[model samples]
Target: MVDFFYSNQLRYRISRHLLYWLSFNLFLAFIWGSTGESYQIHLTVQALLWPARIFVVYGTLYVLIPKFFLKRNLFVFGISYIIWLLLVTIFVQRTVWQYSRSFFFPDWKNYDMFNVTEIMGNVFDLNLAAVFPLVFVFVKFYNAEQKKYLTLEREQYKSELNQLRNQIHPHFLFNTLNNLYSLILKKSDEAEDALIRLSGLMRYMLYEANVPKVPLSKEIEYLRNYIDLEKLRLNASNTIHFTSSMNKDQEIAPFILMPFVENAFKHGISNDKVSTIEISIIANKDLLTMTVYNTKKINANQDNGEKTGVGLVNVQKRLELLYKDNYEMIRNETESHYKMELTLNLI
Candidate 1:
């Protein structure tokens, strides 16, 4: 209970609410006694009633609401509140009336309206005062619920993005190891260099790819390392080109752009074809743009194979989840080549 009420920011709101109600009660007392009563009597009545009101309000709000009302025990809450309210009302009348008579009305008889019937007649007035804290508690509870919903929403986004990132790592490792295995079969000296490059790629994946975003410069370096690993399996005649527009400060979602590059290198080559990949990126102001083009060769599996792969599908979902309306991507294909263009806000 102490932890709930005193959560730094929540404590400020609680203190403000307490002050407002106390001041409002003082205002009501002044208006009630405005006809001919002295200011001292108004202040005395307020001072006496303030503690009684506090006891009722906090009891209903902190105790009854959390303990019964929120627990779906409507019957218990209604019964508990009514019983407590009656006790508070009777105690306040006896205590306040006893003190008030001496200064304001010494000639008054205690038997005039002190009976049960007369006291119960003011139930509406008393209940209104007792139940006034419901408004404050309702608003506080609503705001707390909204904050929780937003926190959960943000965490869900992070989880889905990390899932997409994890998918790319294993797919990339599978292809790179394939190239290393081919080199080992041939007993080529280049197998040692390819192993070293694969180690760097795996290290980056373990350390950085799990993050939500990485610097544009770091992503470019990662892209170059990936291409170097791919070169281990390429023929000397295969041409690869990479270019960038020198925007070092911008950041992008990790692994977001890699699937397109991987798709280019994977499906764009055949053992006997002259394969070529051309990649370029440019950042201007707050916008980052990329173009990846690969020459498409005749596929031996095209007669019985599916066209789209999971890497592309995974990245498509990731872009929609992360960027929403802030990003654009387009794929253009022809008989000879496939091209992908993406534009996104850098910040």
Candidate 2:
């Protein structure tokens, strides 16, 4: 639909320009012919003047404007434009008019070819023909500048997004390796299984998650694997529940939902007390909603300086860069619990 609309607009602009030039030529012929005995002769004379007019207009548009006017060399631009105008007026327009008039209307009075007043008048009239196309020059320049600006902005956005995504890899691997270290120290029977799960997670991070977006199902699988790993480090007192419901496969920004779950497991679990972390995801055709809620351990040392984990901060930044106004996040924290709710418009 958008392409169709722009295509129609381009056609309209082309037709309008063609119509304008046709009308302008006819108008010039009618005005000039009114003073002549034969309108047909005057029309032919006007037709002969078209090449000079085209030269003046297009030279100003494609040459002078780009070379000097747009370069902020106004003094040079002014001087060059004046010289160009005079050269075309003298060598093309005036010569064409003189010879064509003498050929068609042999009895008509002829003026001195180099009369300053006569040449100036001719210059003024020729300039009038060049007026309308100047609007096109300025419009083209404005569009070019706007396109350049948008391209730069998009490149900067991608650079920042990639930097944020890279930050997640180290933060995630560091936490997982710490868990593995504890299991190895205890000589736990689950160490080998944990190593296998870590390998799978690393594979996903290294290979699959490098793209701008991934299938929602793949992201969910990653989250489940991370949750299973965290579960291995927990005792009977720590409870974690994760639920997801998706009607269809959809693509989403990679690892966008991982930080909240990581934050919950990091800050909400304790061996000495009962703690709970609840994570839920619901995705439909138009929207994806995720909620993560965790109860803070009572005796755990709380570092109030950084309420949100490092991974969470990077995720929030990524959300702003990727989704802009299409996503909403709500964060609520109290003495007992912390909750994060995110809603994304998938369409």
Candidate 3:
């Protein structure tokens, strides 16, 4: 009784109610059509033989359908169901025959009505009545299975998304911590400010990014904070620029754009020569477009071993799961520069 209150259990019980009542009532009606012109007698007969009807109907639906037919043993399944039908018919007919003989057909010996031929004649109709609701039962099971499958798929997607989201945090922290270390080593005055920016970045990632979506305005602010931090690492010889225009009300996946910006800084910085990084974001109506380009340093192609930005790989997977075919991305890399352009159709 307590277990039935569980959600899945409750749903299963509710789902079976229709099959149970409909099969019972329909089988009772089929029995009613074959009786003689005595209402009380027929009612008594119905009450008595219902157990046998239940045995055959439920047996065929549960036992035969699953154990035999659904398992691809059709030859044995057909024979088994036919045998069950015949046995139930024989049992009911014998009981009715005995009762009617004792009361209405007393001393009318050697009656033709109780013979095997008469019993065999009704097999087709009995099987037809029994098989009628099998269609509904199969359909209900199919629908239930489909619902279960979809639920599992949704859960799996959420799990994968959470994992990909988790992957972004450590990669981000590693880069920021390295920057902080360099600032401290050089005894740069910007070290304290960089630490403060790192604090803000951590706060946003910890709280805001835990959700599936965040306001596009907040994301851009976060991006700007990161760019400001990176700018601190540059000297007079380097240039970094960011420009964005979007309504504050629009929402987007958290940290979705951070990887491109981070990659631009990672590969485009140098003390040997002047370098520049360009970043742009434009969102209007339901469309979002972003472009990032950075001039690669001479010998910047260090086998950093981390060729694929974990964040970029993570975002691409997330886009596939969240947007499917609704998003487009372009990449152009030349000997001197690399550019990434992303377009998204927002909901």
Worst 10 residues of 3 by lDDT: 1-10
Q: List RMSD in Å for every model shown.
A: 5.7, 6.1, 5.7
Relative to the true structure, candidate 2 reaches a TM of 0.72
Per-candidate TM-scores read 0.71, 0.72, 0.73
The window of 10 residues in a row where model 1 has the poorest summed lDDT is: 299-308
**Model 1 vs. true fold: TM:** 0.71
lDDT of each: 0.78, 0.83, 0.80
Q: How many clashes would you count in candidate 2?
A: 0
In Å, residue 252's CA in model 1 sits off its true spot by: 2.7
Candidates sorted by lDDT, best first: 2, 3, 1
> Following a full C-alpha superposition, what root-mean-square deviation does model 2 have from the true structure?
6.1
Backbone clashes, each candidate: 0, 0, 0
Q: Model 3, residue 16: displacement in angstroms?
A: 7.9
lDDT of 2 by residue, 1-347 (tens): 43332243877657756876888877876787677667776666566767877888778877998899899798998899899889987885357757765776676566666888877876776787777777655666677789899999999999988888888878788889999999999999999999999999999998998888899999999999999998988999988899999998899998899988888887788788889999999998879999999998774445534644678888989888888899999999888888999999876
**Tens digit of lDDT per residue, candidate 3, span 155-269?**
9999999998888878778878888888999999999999989998999999877898999998999999988877776789889889999864688989888888888888887
Residue 72 lDDT in candidate 2: 75
Candidates arranged by TM-score, highest first:
3, 2, 1
